[model samples]
Target: MLRTIAMGVLVGSAILLTLIVFRKKLGWAWLSLFGTHLILAALGIYIVNFSGLLTEIYIPLNPATIGAVTVLGLPGVIMLLGLKITLF
Candidate 1:
């Protein structure tokens, strides 16, 4: 699980870094994406690294995490799509 998460994060960071590097050409839309990524990344890092606190605040292995991930992931996905759409 940890290894999987690590691989996912590595891939995500690489993608985000690409966006960040191209933000100048991407323009204002990239700013929105950067903000969304920041929020989701921070929240995800905290939740994954501090599962005990998250479990205490919410529930362990519950739908809330899944829901949050889904919601948060959408923006990043949109950003990636936007990057592709704009660049391609």
Candidate 2:
């Protein structure tokens, strides 16, 4: 409960800060980038799943993984694969 509330507050603060920092100049650009990242990440995951190359490993669809991929792009997917291979 408390942890959830704190996380919510933290996320809210980050959004507020981004809005303030970007204002109207780059807000749309940022949103578009985020959308592109999301689409690319989803597509990458889908392709990997469809190919069945890594049948032994599975990457869970979740916000953290999505966010990591969003921020890191293809490299992010490679990193996740590496982690999956080494960790599990």
Candidate 3:
């Protein structure tokens, strides 16, 4: 059952990727939206790090944290900060 579900998800993702790549308008829209989101995510982290100088608390700029922020945007940064507060 798990394998079947994974395969279905994989196939669906592949289909979506193909559609995005082939559709010109969709491709542009996808690029612009995600590009903006990635920029916002990086900026959010940068702001936090900059302010950290005063607070002495900040999220480390590692690949894992960066990737999480890049993929999930502002919410990802918030979630990471929350995790740091609760766990560390």
Candidate 4:
């Protein structure tokens, strides 16, 4: 139930943001935002690895991971961590 709610909220927010971006004719701004989010996500993963919290697990840097984090922001990172915990 909680996961479903979270996903619903995430999806709604993404749609809202997309609409706002499109309405303002700021398509390029979305690209910049995505780039920023990707960098933040990469930094977040790096920090997590460096901190040694999940010593035996590592999140790889790749397109799928980047895209998820870019689109969903911090919640996406939390989701990734949750998956890591559950899967491994």
* TM-score versus the correct structure, for each prediction: 0.29, 0.71, 0.59, 0.61
Judge candidate 2 at residue 31 and give its lDDT. 74
Better of 1 and 3 by TM-score: 3
Which prediction has more favorable lDDT, 1 or 4?
Answer: 4
Better of 1 and 2 by TM-score: 2
- Per-residue error for 71 in candidate 2, Å, reads 0.7
The lDDT for every candidate, in the order shown, is 0.58, 0.85, 0.82, 0.83
Per-residue lDDT tens digits for candidate 1, residues 1-88, read 9999999999999999888778757667767876776667556545644667324233223354434444567564344334445665
Model 4 lDDT-worst window of ten: 26-35
Off by over 4 Å in 1: 1-27, 53-88
Candidate 4 lDDT over residue span 37-61, tens digit each: 8899888777766788778878887
List the pairs of residues colliding in candidate 3: none
Q: RMSD, each candidate, Å? A: 14.7, 3.7, 4.3, 8.8
Question: Per-residue lDDT for 78 in model 1?
Answer: 41
In candidate 2, clashing pairs total 0
Per-residue lDDT of candidate 2, residues 1-88 (tens digit): 9999999999999999888867756547777888988999988776766778988878887889888888899999889999999998
* CA error at residue 51 for candidate 4, angstroms: 1.4
TM-score of 4: 0.61
